[model samples]
Target: MTAVIYKSKYGSTKRYAEWLAEALGADLLVRESVRAERLRQYDTLIYGGGIYAGGIAGISLLKNCFPAAEGQRLAVFAVGAAPETPESRKALLSKNFTPAMAEAPLFMLRGAMDFGKMTLKDRMMMNLMKKMLDKKPEEEREEWEKNLMSLWGRASDWCDPANLQPILNWAEN
Candidate 1:
């Protein structure tokens, strides 16, 4: 097994990476810590990131550090507070991945959102997005965004291990 590189701002994605690393007996690293010199020895590169609005972070930069990783055994996963159903999963990939990214193995894992743990910028960004979308009727916004804006409480265990088998299989390959 090679390394699982995670670019997590909020800890959810990193949690999955750690779990996967433990499962595979591999090194778990943050993307920033993986320079080209550091990553060249690894045969597999897995990138995990969280989603906000509609974009995935850090994975886009992987090509720069590990261009060869593009054709290798690459896996990606995202953790989010949104429900993980076939429909929600579809929306997540559509929102985050470009057409070129569709080929990489993709996984959607449920994640927690704690309003209190959020940084000031993230808090403000969520609030601002909510307010901007508030002008529209409730029915206009997508279901996921509606759930994303609801910040009344904290949830810690959205990354269900039962749903982690796909990741296990991918890493094993």
Candidate 2:
């Protein structure tokens, strides 16, 4: 059986985790309170989190346990503002993860961003980012940074249930 582990801020990744756990009928784990050694109990692992400035969900989990969690089928899913298109797939997978993680199966799901849920720091940073972007000439702005600020999928079931088919397939295999 698989365990669904997630690290969510502002509930976007939590929503995805709930949907995934329910659909797969798997046990769910929230990263903050998880027992590190307990991870060895499952052969299949599903780790998920919302994106923030191009970082993975539960990064601490991976850092603390990836080296010890042997014989597990690790599949990562990121619920982000990125679309589920090929461009997004390329960016999400290629830009993130270490060599070991890059070797593991990865999926990108659409996540929401609520300005209201953002902290005062995040708001200030966003404002600074916007102001910086404005200072740049449109043609001179870096492609990657532009995409980072432009969230394609917002406030919907953009993370399609069908996308989790890979999880099912992986489990079956």
Pick the TM-score winner.
Answer: 1
Question: Where in model 1 is the C-alpha error above 4 Å?
Answer: 69-71, 84-102, 149-157
Model 1, total clashes: 0
- Give model 1 RMSD, 1 decimal: 3.1
Evaluate residue 132 in candidate 2 and report its C-alpha lDDT on the 0 to 100 scale. Answer: 88
Off by over 4 Å in 2: 67-69, 84-96, 137-159
TM-score of each: 0.79, 0.77
Clashes of each: 0, 0
**What is the TM-score (0 to 1) of candidate 1?**
0.79
Model 2, residue 8: distance off in Å is: 0.7
